[model samples]
Target: MSDDDGLMLNFAIPDNGTTTTANTQSKNVKVRGGRWKDRRILKLELEGRPKEKKVKGPNSIPIDASRKRRMEEKPSKPKSSQSNPTSEFKRAKFTETKGEHGGKNDSYVSSLFTNNTASTQEVPEESKEETKTYLPSNAPDKNATSFAGLGINEKLSKHLTDHQRFKYPTKIQKLVIPNLLVTERDLFVKAQTGSGKTMAFILPIFHKLMMEYKHKIGRESGLFAIILTPTRELANQIYSVLENLNRCYPFLVPGIVIGGEKKKSEKARLRKGVNILVATPGRLADHLENTKTLDISQLRYLVLDEGDKLVELGFEETISKITKIIDDNSKIDETKDKWQGLPTRRINILCSATLQNNVKQLGNIILNNPEMISVDREVEGTILFDDDTTGEVQTNNEHESFAPDQLIQSVLIVPPKLRLVTLDASLVNIANKIEQSGESSRSIVFFSCSDSVNYHFDVFTRDGKKFKKVKDEETGETKTILVSPDDSADEDQDDAELTSPIINKNTIIYKLHGSLSQQTRTTILQQFIKDDPKFPHKVLFCTDVASRGLDLPNISNVIEYDAPFTIDDHLHRIGRSARVGAKGNATLFLLPGLEEGYIDAKLKIVHPREENLRVTKYETILSSAFGEKNSTTKNKFDKLGNWDIHATTWHLEVERWLLENSSALAKASHAFTSHIRAYATHLSQERNFFNVKLLHLGHLAKSFGLRETPKNLGKKSSKNNDKFEELENGGKKYKKEDPRKKMLRLAKLAVNSTSEYNY
Candidate 1:
């Protein structure tokens, strides 16, 4: 994550986690000296397109001209597949650095197999006791399970296990592999992040090609499979997985094409021919119109990894263009009777961690009767599931981030100005704790945009990257906000003592993100994978690219250096750590001050609103964890907060109503607790400012505005509001009436009076 203008931000920590938006109130609050907006952080990019390029003249040769010539010469190339427009981030063309390694184009390199890729090649046979329609990827006795049971190539099965220790098929892999291998089914899988969806589609499709077509597959069919990913990082991730699996069959040529690198090497690679190609949609589209040697007329497999993100990021047109060619060509291939006895069929598979409407729409256009597979959020199942029934329950809502039971999650609220300092302290605490226990720990720190990513990276590594100078508009005084405190502490700096231990002889930090050149990114990942011979990487600073599909080893902690834009993002970030049944820790950095995190971006310093009920929401997150059943949980908010609202009696009335009702709602599903925690965090992040006069005038009401449940809305309340004295911050303490107690009592009462329950 380096500072650039691609994946960007305009910060305001809203009631929900989102970036690049804020309430444009008329009044501008003053900060330090200038208006808040002037002093606010300006984020350009998070991943790639780190900086805006100088505008080139319209007459100048276009950056993608090399690819454009192929489409012009080739009559068979589809017109719509040619994307002349620039990609998001408005990426300018990049050239290969001098002395860069130009890998061989004609032969497959041994890049996939690491030193220990086959550390344990021999595996025991799978158990016959398991005969479920679906299977868990990892089991308690994973050694007892095998992919061979699912009719996989025994050699392929053995390699997969050794490559990544994928002992058994993940829920996605278990169901998806067979469908792709045996049938003509299209798939739209909505599994939890890190559930092995990449392997599910890759293993089956690649295996089929190696068995049937081999190296000549591309020569005859011209790009047998086209895997489209949203980002270059993801393309590389898919490429790595596919390339390693390609080791099981050397004849299968797998390659990747992305932006931010010279097109010559990729073109040469494609010219020599590639059977399976993983590419970012924009770059692939660029090639479809330009590279004459590259052809997708016989493309059979089209997989959209992170389909939701691709659609959300506005890649619909590009995807459709690629799909259109595949669609048109598949019909031609069928008409020619090429697949009389072969398993080759144009298959469309879309996989996303979060299932949203756009993703479904994308699938509808590309896939025919595509099946979905969602992993359980609370627990990974060990038994079989029905083909029609995916076990998608309300409790397993995708809005909540999924962490394995082994991951220990916690949060620390820090003032914005102190973020860098606080990060140091937290790291020291974690390292010291681990050192005392005589254990090694690996961690990844994620940021919202590349600017933040690069800033933190510079600070952590003590790199001399220039820290931007910010001026106080009123005073005209400037200072570097993110300079490494140890390396270049400002003369007037106050927090001189704050510093995180950068690295010792035992530690190494690695950086990975899309903004870097493709070559550098690849080198960083490969070195990270091998843990570098000299400086073994223990910590990685990156953006969300590392969050998806790329499973690095020995990751003990995932740190959200910046609050993620959505709950899914939060899940994916942490998902990088506690992967495949390993213990890890995650810490979310929250900035509640004007000088710090997202809150600082807003124009005004607003106080907390509805202070009383905020307690219950947080307590819900804690208490619900101990409860086994949603209906039986008796947790309350009394122990949650002080429940002290210094307001008129009318405000107390509202608080009472909320407390009495929210408890029951919280118990309706397990996800409610997570929702409550997220809600509370949002409240803390927002500038809390509600009119006390409105409450005194009886203008305040429960279940008002764009709220969720009003408990039998359109009907009158079952119990009337009671009369009470307006005690300052405590209308009625009511004898040990802690929020938790109230929750337990209400839960029991609601369960007993089933007729009165609105849920």
Candidate 2:
């Protein structure tokens, strides 16, 4: 064997010109130079030792030839049914299934869930089918070609098709019109929003009156119908619809009596006589008790439009009183014999989009042997559902409230500091889209209070000015800010190119709220609904005044700048769009952190039939609004820096504008204060998600372009000092009111001052 098979040792020693001899017992050893000539050897003394070898263990043993051959010859077996317990549980907990619409059925637990059972419940097999309840729809009937098919007279049908361009009736109209015309039973109709519920009842009343005109049905034929609405705006809209339908028979006069109108004028009109009257609950109740000329004995139909809204607005007591008074005054039943087609007794119809408990109570108060008509819903007969086991009343939670499927609902979780800048960017993006498509777009941004609306409207329409930067002298950080009209003489200056107003010149902004005069409210609403081709992009900044019953066409987008106080309000805010089968978009702005939890806790299951809610990235919106500026370097941080830079610059300009304009600053401060007060008024159940105490005061102030701290904005108004007279002024001296009592008084005032238009 070669000497390499044996272990060998080597050591080094200092070179001293001495010869060394090698003596070994085995012949396998070899020796070389001993003066450390070979540097690779260790420079230490060592006793020669052999290397130890490791013994083979079980894991290191090679497989037997027979077993290897058998394994290679046979195919591998499938995995067994049993799996690790923890892994099986994980798979069971998070197994996602594809819905019919291609959305994933998220089975993961929500972080907002407080119930332990709900969070840790065992998931059922997705393959097993579960019963699903569908909400109501407003889809038009393809088979019913014309209004005549739904029992409308020939004249009215022709006018509808040729004049109004209403060729086909919706599903609600098809069901409701025939029932009203054929039978005298009262109706409680529940249908989707924007589903022509107005025409559903209007046509039947019109057709009956027109058919009986030869029998002396004229404008002087006594008040035949009384339509009660919750708001003046809706009452006005109903009157307009009635006018459009009256073209077939111009002699059938319809008049409106609502608040914000002169009672003298209404009384004069009532004396002149009107066959049909449309009025709000409060105004109508007043006319019923005060005005004797307003006759209701010959009333054939008492229709309650938006019955749920009326009840929600605390009009139930007024409605009940009106109905009782009318009942006590019904002495002309003999006159109904002459009107052959009309109902022998006054017919009561309650209409609403959803059937809540309050609406059901209102229906019970109005309807007599009513037919509950809910098209496209699975339930039959009546909407008064009862639990089978407990015999307790139950509202259909599945169809409690919902948005149209065509409405694209999305949400953006932006930090409070970025809300104002993001809002500007979003508007710019929408305007750009309208310009690109060459289509007119109407957008509405809803705020919490009128002050907020006022402040924001001023910010946008400040003479169409843009913000610019200048150098600061105190900080010496090269920071300067100024504002001027975009078309100013300084257009050629370098500052002009820095930042322009987010709103376009073609944009028209309108503000409407309860504080405005009635005439102003009517004028603005009329102008808003009227199409203006000159301004393709129209934005209305208002509170909840415009949320219900008013049908403004071509409303392409809705932005909820402030979260609604309740889920019902949220539904109504978004219901402004995607009406009558038209496509639209709704965006909700939510602050980061707890506000984000509102999505899964409340909004996730709002619509039972489909999942349309999506979370949009704020950065993408920012990019679309403010186009990317030219940069030398491109990276993640660089992109973030660009967004931050643009937002800072725009906000700086707004701050500077506020500094110069004292009036605007005052409005901003009031708005900031009112917003906090309103934020506390959210419903108790939803308070956990929108707690006012959790807000970052400084950051929220930034959104309103207010640099002052929250404490300064929240100071009590000094104007109230006039109420407390001094002893020297010859009036009784008064002590300062306790702060707690003052706060309680203000809170009560806030609650009591809430109007239907604002709240």
Candidate 3:
């Protein structure tokens, strides 16, 4: 037989059996002959089975009559010829059940992904009246006739008008100068920062000393006044003010003895004698104890400038010691005999911007039978010299910390990843304004830590070459020499780095913080104050070090790049500008989400006037940051499209710069870690708004040009584990350090830092 004819076996069906449709179809279907392995079992399995044959007659089972009736009554199921019995019905299209597995997991994974589309919801525009920060009217005050009207000496007032440019006394000066010049009673002076508090107390002392000099009183006579401050900067500033006043009367000498100065020089000057002395608490205490030439037995005035800060710096004990020593040295009999027209006994004047509990406590220690003098809040843009206003004003402490009315304060609700670019944009805007105005302008940027200030200073100055100061042999003129990395040591680099900028090309950049040497800090402050007509814009990146008592003139803007530790800090940071009613702007950069609540919960109290504050959109700032031609793009014709391009390109440039320089990368990492640690140090009351636990660590790292995950970035290798191991028995393993102890150590570092005093 042929291969096709090999399967010849056939089965016959009886005629009586009913032919089902499946069986009939199978009967007609043919199978090809093949080897046993190739035969299809599945195909055979599809065929329907035949019914079994019944046994003959009585031997087989009898059929019941009801069986036919039941079979006839049952409805038959329709069978389709194309249906396969072995195949499963299609599964119901997958439908996700709602709320399964405790709903979707909450995650911060989205923060890790870069949002290429900078699609931000449009922030509502505030009304002109609501957003506007109105400057105090320049309209002539009928009462502000001259400094002489405020009880200033005629010669001193004339000199001030001619040289010092005292057109008119400020509100604080109007209130304080007259009281100090006329009364021998102790005074507690409280007013807004930048409201002429320094001049207030200084002028009265100058007037009294100038009056005494006419009686042939010289520096050799005795020390008539001693001014104590919290920081060396403030003390030096007060001394300078005294010197300026002294230009009229050179016989009345002023001397400063602050930290970071040569004791020998201070001693030598003291031996020559000074009519008025200005010194920091710690240094003054040392001088009183160690320097015998420093005589306070004839001291007539004890003026504590920035008294609140003096107490805040934990100098209360030192100040107490100094005050007690002064009391013991100054005999009532000697003070009465030394000078006429001045107080019979030493008059105590405590000047502070805010009257918090600590300040009150400080006042109790230094001030006796004190008269409380403060600007009345009810009278807008006016100072009340009404003698009836006595005792401490019973008001909210929050209200007491209000910013100056002329300061245009705004808040930017920015994301962590966008902070760097947004800051650059804001600075560019300020620079552009300076360029358009054709006038010299100064600005300050406040950071949370010194490391952050250093990192940002490097980032901004990376594009320019550095130069160092050199003295010319023939002309004897000091000039700068181009300093290259190969020729320069690491320590000398920062001195020349301030002259460069990556974005604000014409703007000079300066970095200041507590970490800088005292001399370096003093030099930078002097340079910032000295206006070089060549550079129109000057920006200083500093910590709270620049926020306090140092009066930097003509500061047009202040940028609080980091949220302050307290509301008082926030007020003080902005107080650097808008001095004595000058128009100025301030911006606070706040991360979005929980931090946004600060605007209403805390900031409103410090800035009650709605017109002085507005919410600035980060998108607007980012878009305006780039010019007509994107600097990153080489092609002039290739224009940038949107905010996303500006942010991404700028951040990428920063990251690239960090990658190329290992030192900068290390600084950035250090700044990132320090920032996180500092963020946790906010006051307990402010924890609701600035909770570190709510922060997105990965996103914040991007601000510092860091790409590593937070876990990896903060994790240190176990390199010291071997050092802790014992030598016996292959070394016993040391237990892990307690996290609570680690946290306490970091807190101690923050508290002990000099950041608060410097600013």
Candidate 3 lDDT tens digits, 1-759: 337657653333334355545545454433444544333442343345333333321113344655656767988755642342211111112112233211123111122124322223234553555445565522123367688877787899999889975678877677778888888888888877887788888888888877874365678877889998877777778888888988888889899898777889889999999989998888888899999999888888899988877777788899889989998887667456546777787899888888787787777677776777776373322111212245342322232657877778888888788788889889988887787789999999999888789899888877655557789999999997656435566654465235566666678888888767788888888988987887889889988877778888999999999999988888788888887767888999988677888888888887777567777766556655653456676533122344454456667678767767788888898788667767878888999988877777767888888765334233321233233233322577535566434433444344454244542
Off by over 4 Å in 2: 1-137, 376-379, 383-399, 465-501, 609-611, 629-641, 712-745, 756-759
What tens digits encode model 1's per-residue C-alpha lDDT throughout 530-578?
6433333366777666776667777877888666645556667777765
In order, what is each prediction's RMSD in angstroms? 29.8, 19.7, 17.0
TM-score for model 3? 0.77
Ranking by lDDT: 3, 2, 1
Candidate 1 ranges beyond 4 A from true positions: 1-144, 162-164, 213-221, 331-344, 377-401, 437-439, 463-505, 532-537, 592-759
Q: What is the Å distance of residue 319 in model 3 from its true position?
A: 1.0
lDDT of 1 at 683: 26
TM-score of each: 0.53, 0.72, 0.77
Give the clash total for candidate 2: 1
What is the clash tally of candidate 3? 5
Mind giving the per-residue lDDT tens digits that candidate 2 earns over 388-488? 46534544333555677667787877777678888998888888788778888889999988889888887877665443455677886764344554545
When 2 and 3 are scored with TM-score, the better candidate is: 3
